[model samples]
Target: MADISFAGQVAIVTGAGNGLGRDYALELARRGAKVVVNDLGGSGSGVGASATAAAAVVDEIRAAGGEAVANTSSVASREGGASVVNSALEAWGRVDILISNAGFLRNGRFEDLTDEQIDPILDVHLKAAFYVGQPAYRAMRANGYGRMLFTGSASAMFGHAWQTNYAAGKGAMLGLSNVIALEGSAYGIQSNVLLPTANSRLAAEMDQGFMEIPAFAQALQNADFSTSDGRVVPEFNTPLALYLVSKDCTATHGVYSSNSGRYARVRICAAEGWVAPRGATPPSIEDIASHFDQISELGDFSEPMTVYDEFTAVAKAARKQGVYP
Candidate 1:
């Protein structure tokens, strides 16, 4: 196989001061990408900021004979998000790759969570994608090439206590990436989501008891989320993330997971649910209860790419029962 390269490509990695984002920036720079390492230099809880973290990473890249610049811009705000992209543009003239990896954890019981915990999570994880992504998308559309990767989490798919705010933000990345894939198809742009589980300060701070429930516990046991020393380090996830945002990759509208050493595609499939009768009167509660098994069954399923595709699947199922022409 030919080696992958990002020569002449300009990349932006948010939260590159530490953890997974740091790994991403370093690797992209090694592969010949001119990277803008954007990090707010705040704590894991999104408290304060500094330019030191980003600057240090930039220095590392330059020391290694790679090109990179530091941009300490908060992605949680509209202006800050645009500034992130602008840094890449001003330095290298265009954005060919974007890794939306900036975020922090604010955990609490759903009912006990306050606006402080919830609002910032939304701003950084969900709204930041829109703010930073819009400008990057425009640049990619104009240049006729781009690769976008949205950082997501397994907590969003599987339940995690005290992470309602975090999960809510991570889960929305799938929808955002999917739409971008569809819209950017004609322009040679690919967008994808990465659900990564790695050991970092954020991981260390998580309450181990949060996964005490049988279901969550079982998920942890089933996945070998550890390295030789029993630590799932960030390097385990960097390879997959790098590929997804590389010019060689052709995947789009895809959600993939990198947990421990495991890599897999995370799909959202619609079941061939039971269709009620097409008569004048609608089905009653008793009718629904009777067909509950079939409705919940996953023996047959389809992965719909868009709303129209999902509706078409339902229409097909209805037609099979002679409920539609």
Candidate 2:
């Protein structure tokens, strides 16, 4: 295959002021994409703003001989999201890729969460995806080709103390991406979410001791993080992020993960559930309890690519057990 190139494509990368988002914007720019570097320039906890951060990235890109523009907009608001994408359209005339990587950390225990603590998390992470992603999606559909990369978190899939709000917001992006993938399938537009485990500004600010766990701590201690310009930059997942949104990658309706250079696909699947005999009345509550183990078993689970595919898998499972023809 020929070398992957963004050549004439335009990309909008949110939260490009620093860390992972900055790396994504810079790399995309290096690969020939005309980039819109959007950063809220807020505090790590999701407060405050400045336009300088975004402009700094644009400067770096320009200094390296790449085309880029700065956009200082809050992804948490309707107008802000639209403005971010509009920056690219106004400058480049078309939008081909969107990297929704803007977000902030607000960690609070489950019981401690209240309207004040959770709203910002929901606004910036969940609602913000809808706000900005929709505009870009429309443009991509019109052009009949596009790729999107949303940021997700492993904490949501598993569990992380003091991060209830953050995790909830992150988890919600999967469903959003799934729908976009289904609808955009026919238009040559692909949407996928990334669950990256990296030492970005947000991840570095986490104080829950989760990283102190031997598995994570030892890895970081021993790992030789590949650097850029003499700095130990461990956004090693950036390369995978590039491939995921590239024209060469046709992946959609999928949640992929990368960390410390390790990569994998994350999925929600259904087990081959226990079935009652054909023509029998619905099983009793006691029957369900008796077969709980079989019903919940993951040993033979199947991963469905779309909602309709899940139904097909269910029907096949039923037929195998004589519950369907």
- Give the count of colliding residue pairs in each prediction: 0, 0
Best-fitting candidate, measured by TM-score? 1
lDDT of 1 by residue, 124-239 (tens): 99999999999999999999999999999988977687799999999999999999999999898999999987878786557676675677678778965345354478898999
Residues 1-325 of candidate 2: C-alpha lDDT, one tens digit per residue: 7878999999999999998899999999999999999997898888899999999999999999999999998999999999988998999888999988888887665776788779999999999999999999999989999999889988887666678899999999899999999999999999999988765567655776545456656765786656333332436778888999999998888999886556899878889988776775888999999989989887677888767888888878889878778
Per-prediction RMSD in angstroms?
2.0, 3.7
Q: Name the regions of candidate 2 deviating beyond 4 angstroms.
A: 209-234
Residue 228, model 2: lDDT of 33
Candidate 1 backbone collisions, by pair? none
Model 2 / residue 57 / CA error / Å: 0.5
The TM-score measured for candidate 2 stands at 0.90
Question: What's model 1's lDDT at 38?
Answer: 95
Q: What is the lDDT of candidate 1?
A: 0.91
Candidate 2 contains a number of clashing pairs equal to 0
Worst 10 residues of 1 by lDDT: 223-232
* TM-score of each prediction: 0.94, 0.90
